[model samples]
Target: MGKSQKKRSMRRHNPMRVPDSHLPKGLAAASESSSKTEAILPIIQKMQGADAAERKWACVAVSNLIQNDPSTRRLLQGKNIVGTLITRLTDSEEEVVVEAAGALRNLCIDGGYDICAEMYNKSILVPLQTFVPKLSTTLSQYLDDQKTAPENAQKLVYEFANNVITLLWCLSETSNKALNAINQLQLVPFLISFLGARQKIPLATVTAAAQCLYVLSDDNPPAIADLRADGGYIACLLSILQEPPQDEADPRTGTLRVLAAGILRNVAPLPPPSVASALDLDAEIVLPQLTPLLSISLTEVSETALQLLGSAPETEKPKDSGLKNTPKSDHKSPAEVGLERLENRLRTVQLALEILTGACATLPDPQPDVLIDDEDDDEEGDENSDDNPDADMATPEEAVPDSREQTQSLPSLVTPLLQLIQPTTLSFPPLAAPSPHPPTTSALSAIHLAAFECLNNIFLTLARDRHANAADVGAVWDAIWTALGLVGTQTGLGQEQRRAVWEAATGVLWGVATVSRGIVEPKPEQVQALMALCDGATADAQLRVKCIGTLEALAQNPAFVDANATIAVYLLSMLPSANGPSPAGTEPMLQAASSLIDIYSDEDAPWDINFRSGGYLARLQGSVDGIKTAVRAIDRRKEGGKELRRRGEEVRDNLVAFIKYRKDLGL
Candidate 1:
């Protein structure tokens, strides 16, 4: 207790102050690569210079150069730029601090996961954390006395708070170490304070606060405990999430509401009796709370996407239609407005889908109840205490899913998630590319990625719901495949985005096949999509392996007979001509053969007419030697090759056995 008191007093005395003498005492390592240091060296020098203006602009220059430009971001990272920006977070000049924070935040997004982990590794957390206590003080001032600062100063403080919380959120999302540091710094209470006095601050700042808290609350026992202990905390989040009357015209309302719901989704308790069994949870008390929270998010996700579509700038084609566009006040161009609206809508839907996913998601098949002792009444001794440093913080490993079940209302969300799976078109007549190519960054692709991921989780739960008829299953399957086509065909997509979409989409198929089994049936077109993915050069080798494995899983279902037969016919038809332009890889054909064998392994399984009368087995028999050649032709050292080879050979044995079985019957 005494040590904690001393530490708090010391922090209070120097909440955000870092002396020049202590500035050099940091963990920024030496340049790992100096090749590009010469180019970015000037900005580094200016950042360290005594002139505050130069330092501020130096940060601004790095931020601007790295925005949406990966090559420039990489060059900057190699130049000790991240370390220099960390030092500037403690700059004496306020403008320099804000600009430096902005630069660091952009570095995280532009450089992605590696740079965020690098920033945490370089000890950026300590300096960045000092701002939270300081910002908390400013927030307290806003609650007590709004006139503590002039209006300009208050807005600046709001902007700084926004940048700091947002950067912290970004870091926490990417790095486990950063999350540990944030929890140790006792940041959640301060973050939640922003939520309490939200209306007294900027909505953007509140959104940032909500986002940061949402990230921290995910499966963190201490953070969840803190949120639950303070009833007002949950109240504030729920208040922000409560739907406003339709006439209210706050432009940022949708984002704020969804972010609050995300925090709720992260921190809420076990889903009620409706999700699975009510044995563990207090159903009467929990259901009312969980249901309304879900109702708000589900309503918001669909309504928000609709609002985004409606927000699109209607292209007034004066040339083709010979009608003058309506006069309007001049501001940003329609293209700019369309992009902004789409981006905001996607962000809202992305956050909301996370909540909807949690709402429908269940705990994985139970493991040993290691964390709880059913017979022991000694839980009181295990309670988190004030002296325990990590009482509230959960390690990344400990941050599991919490209180996510949409038992009652999950059926309502299928239409919206499926709708989101497809791309939303914006009729922007002026978004012409300079070089007849697509833009580097795309929000439409991102929206589908989020939707695809949410649907992946939603599928298992939906599959278990016997009330969801065949049409629902078919629609869900169709939407997932359609979204894959849209995202897979996206021009100018970066390799990373491509991998993410395929992973999410394939995850939906593979996860459902693994968990749902006979409850769900796959379509023939779905089979075609999987085969295309397995053989496409665009898909990395590992994902192609997964595609074949998923195809194998789907083959076991009785409803999968049609898809299996369709694939078998397609493979046999393409085999003799496979050496041509088509990419009928050996692995895909082998998996199809395996699926065909598995389907026929069941006695009640019906054979396709092509198999019965078309002498297909004999033709396939003729291709057996070629199949062996192709199997041997596959590079054994490629990713997932060992499993592929084993599965392929096993499939060969099955094919041979099935042919012998048919011949024995004199087919």
Candidate 2:
């Protein structure tokens, strides 16, 4: 025992100095046991010399009494108490140091800056920092130290580390400077290295590091690169990704998605790797694995992957520079075939989708029990005993792979991953409505965004190979229309969210125009719907602009040009000066007119239809009465409503010019 512990034990048991109240409660309560010699200070001093059993009894008594009284804990704050505890940290008696570390941990709890500063001043934090690394080295040398020696010792140290981390978390939460300290410590790196240690510690440490990285990287993109450099954050994260997924019912996949998003978003616009090798570990190795993750059930994952994918092959711009098309130049070499290699990529993606779809279908169903024998029971012997050093603290090779092997493809990864993300038939529980009533149809908004992205990929694929997957293209179009319709309804979506949905819908429209244009038909019903939408767009500035673009694409279709004379007349009237103020509305009508003019003026299909002859000319003549009627009604309004009068007159002038030109051109 340490000399100070020896002195303290003597003082508590000495016949000359000990008080009756100082007697241990258990000893005092015992009716048959009355050994006065054991109560004397000199006699108690002998207790320390008696044997390991006697010393254990004294240690237990001291621990109990100190815990029972708040005053006893406060008394330990004396300078001598601090020095004594530090001494035991290096003591040969394993029991002594373990108890001492425990006491120090409690003392540090909820401690103020002054106490922490004092600890720092005493070099306490340094020693605690060394404990983890030191534990590794000492495990072999100190295997036979005490009665439950190694386990108890590790428990004490783990508890101590846990307490320290708790304090650090509190500090990080309250002070940005403290968080900076943690990042500077490269604690993330430390935790990863120590993943070879106990599972709980690494889990706790890495999770904290993840949280810290999350806060540090928010909004600032370059910080992500810095974080990656800190002990290969990207590599460690990739390791997590390569690891086999837990069985279904586990939520870690969601957690992984969240962490991956934070890291990927931060590292956005990944710089060209410093190396120039063809099998660039950063690109070829990283991109293939990550591309598949774009199909994960999390929207954030797809979003992150989208951003990251844009960063690949920084050397060249892909043929389709816009968002929807896969960049043919994403790969560095001709063998990669850029966009041309999409067929092979699609096959790979299809395989993953099929697996994921099946897994989602079966994951939620309960299965029969099949328990395996308990192998961990023997390993965990007695947690309080430090004696079998090899017991629980020994590193397991299977826990994590070596740095080299970690780069290799994982086994059963796809199947397990699919099981975790299997989709279920979603229930559209009520959301706040225009009135408090049940919704008529369920929405797919609740489906994981990863799944949605997978569907998006499917759309892109089917759209690319329209001749082969015509039915799939049609089905995707129907689903897209349904999704847009659901989003358009007032099912409690806020304005911003609604705007986003509209934006996505417009994106889908653009995709269809580019990838599946051959499938669009200018059916009368479709044309009528398009016209009504044009009217609506004419009224709303935003919708007007978007509809104008869509309509222009529709005008390109030979089907529309072949069947409809009205389509040409429609284009002729929207020329800045259009047939009297379009009764439909201003913005949509003006935008539609603007678009139609552009379409007819195109080299391929010049405007040739006569607006003042045949069925087309009669249609224009019939529309004048409606314009005059609306103008007269506007003229009767308050005197201040003259703006509407001016607009109405302008519309009339444009209509007259359009008619005159058509009449001059013989149909």
Maximum-lDDT candidate: 1
- TM-score, every prediction: 0.63, 0.38
State the weakest 10-residue window (summed lDDT) of model 2: 1-10
1-667, model 1: which lDDT tens digit per residue?
0000111112111111001111122223212222333446667777788888878878877875654444456667767788999988888999899889888876765565667778888988878867877887777877799887898988889888888887787777664556667778767788888877776778878877877787678766667777776666766675664546222444356667666666665565633322322333223322333333222232243344445445544554322322122112223445545445544554555555555555445434222213323454332332222334244434323432333343345445556666666643321101232211122124444455666666665555544444433235545665667666655543232234555677677867765565445545756667777776665643464456457556656665655566656655655654433344225466556655565556455544554443665566676666666666665554435554544554555565567778788778664
Q: What TM-score does candidate 1 get on C-alpha atoms?
A: 0.63
Best-fitting candidate, scored by TM-score: 1
Question: In model 1, which regions exceed 4 Å deviation?
Answer: 1-42, 243-251, 270-341, 363-411, 424-441, 465-467, 470-482, 489-493, 507-529, 535-598, 608-667
TM-score of 2: 0.38
Model 2 misplaced regions, further than 4 Å: 1-219, 245-249, 253-475, 485-488, 491-499, 522-544, 562-594, 603-667
| lDDT by residue for model 2 (1-667), tens | 0000111112111111011222233423432233221233321332244454443333333333333232343333332344445554565665655555654444443232333344444655444555545554443333345344556665565544444444343333333334445454444444444332323332433344444444445433345557556445555554655566443232333343344444444454434452212233423443344445435343332333334434544455445423221112223433223322232232223323332322222111122233435444332222223444333321223322232232222212322232223322221222332211101011112222223333333333333332322233444445555555544433233223333344334434533443455456545654554455555444354454454455555556655554335555554354332345554454334444444434434333432342223355555555555554554455313432344344444555455556566566555
Question: CA lDDT of each candidate?
Answer: 0.57, 0.39
Positional deviation of 531 in candidate 1, in angstroms?
Answer: 2.4
